[model samples]
Target: MSNARLPSFRFLIGFEAAARLGSYSRAAEELCISQSAVSHQIAQLEEQVGQPLFRRKGRGVELTVSGRLLLDSVGKSLDQIRSGLSRIETYMDDSLVTLVCPAPVVKGWLQPRVDRLLQEHPALCPIISIDETARYIDEMDVDIAITREPLKQRGVLEVPLLDDELVAVVRPDSDGQPAGMLCLETDLTSDRIGPFIREHFGNLRRLAIYDDPRLLLDAALRGHGVALLSRLLADEALRSGQLRHLAAYPSLPLGTLWISRTEGEPRLPLVRQVFDSLLAYSKG
Candidate 1:
């Protein structure tokens, strides 16, 4: 098909739906079509897009990098149209949604949820706040936030998501040796390294803290201080032996992440949609 005629919004919509939801059956249900129809539409769209959009994994699916890029490209136009219609119906208000999260959590946890968000609520545009500078965080003005501390906020409503946990970590290469002052990429005291310090050494010594976990993992490999980190964040380090659990200590209570939204504002359907998606996303 020619580029001009290739948009095939129906096909693109179906494919995007299938790719993001990870199932042709669900996509079909959402589109009010048969599963076979959903598959044929996606297959045709894939041929036009000139690449495979999804890889079958047993009963579910996962998108390829190209699939992700296509969704990104076409998502905004679709969202705009959807939001415009929503506004015309005077059924909901416009919205801007934002989230705040630590870098590692952004990388491991939230990244996987974006696609599902697109599939579930195509009209809600989102911006993610990842790099949390002390000054910037204080000045942040967002509609929704995912924060570690559920401290009092002026206008935000906070709903706790899950309990964050800290696990021991080290470099994949080095033998777990020496084991004194635990080395971390950055300010360990703030990242929950204090408990390990009190437990392991009896006296807390805040020595040799790097701002990067790569360096801390290096030191841990070289038999430095035990690296305390989130199990989700340190999975690769644990798997490769770059980080190792020094003791079977009870997982550290890093704190609970909350879904914070501004109070008093009407719940935009898109926002409520994403909120529901996230809640279900949490269960999964």
Candidate 2:
């Protein structure tokens, strides 16, 4: 139980490398030092242990009984140290929360309330990224995800965030006659919305087509044309009188938006808090 006579880290590192590689020169090359340094360190380790750890072989070196025993303990220690460092790096900034959201959700929903969310939780550091395809939520390291579809996987908890409907939105100040139609590509691909638009509004000129509904919302706000977009996305604008539901077209039923996080015990309380806050915000 004497802590005073422990071998130095440098000696242990040199010893482990030399014993594993069976060559002081190879250990030195791996350690980015000269063979003399490796030899010196190992010699010091041997002096401290009061036993010779290596034996001369034909061209390389071989581990003696003591050397092999030390290497086993030293290698395990190094592995644990490396794993500890990696775990520590993740906690260096606990306030940092990563979120992956679809572009439409980010622009129309999250972007508008970001200022208020921070005001409520000033210490929170949010890193929000757009993942329209929802790839990062399943494949990458993220704290929260908002997607059009729910993720049903082990250890993942997904809940409905908002129930939305597809509607044609136009600027409030618009005269009865609009310029053209602005459409989301996905809406046009939907079985219901796609065929409905073609049958009813086919006579109207198509001004612009966009893959992202955020873009369609923007174009509608700018008076470019009538935008076929989700009501959830246009809610802020509609409430502010910047945009209005085009009364001529019936609102088509869209689906529920989902908010998801890993199930069971949470790593960070802030992630759970933020997730709950978002759900509450959506309901409000």
Query: lDDT by residue for model 1 over 161-240, one digit each (tens)?
Result: 75667665545444545344554543346445655556764443544667765455456656556565666556445655
Number of the top candidate by lDDT?
2
Each candidate's lDDT (Cα)?
A: 0.64, 0.83
Task: Give the TM-scores of the predictions, in the order they appear.
Answer: 0.47, 0.66
Over 4 Å off in model 1, which ranges?
1-96, 131-141, 170-182, 185-192, 201-208, 213-226, 235-250, 264-267
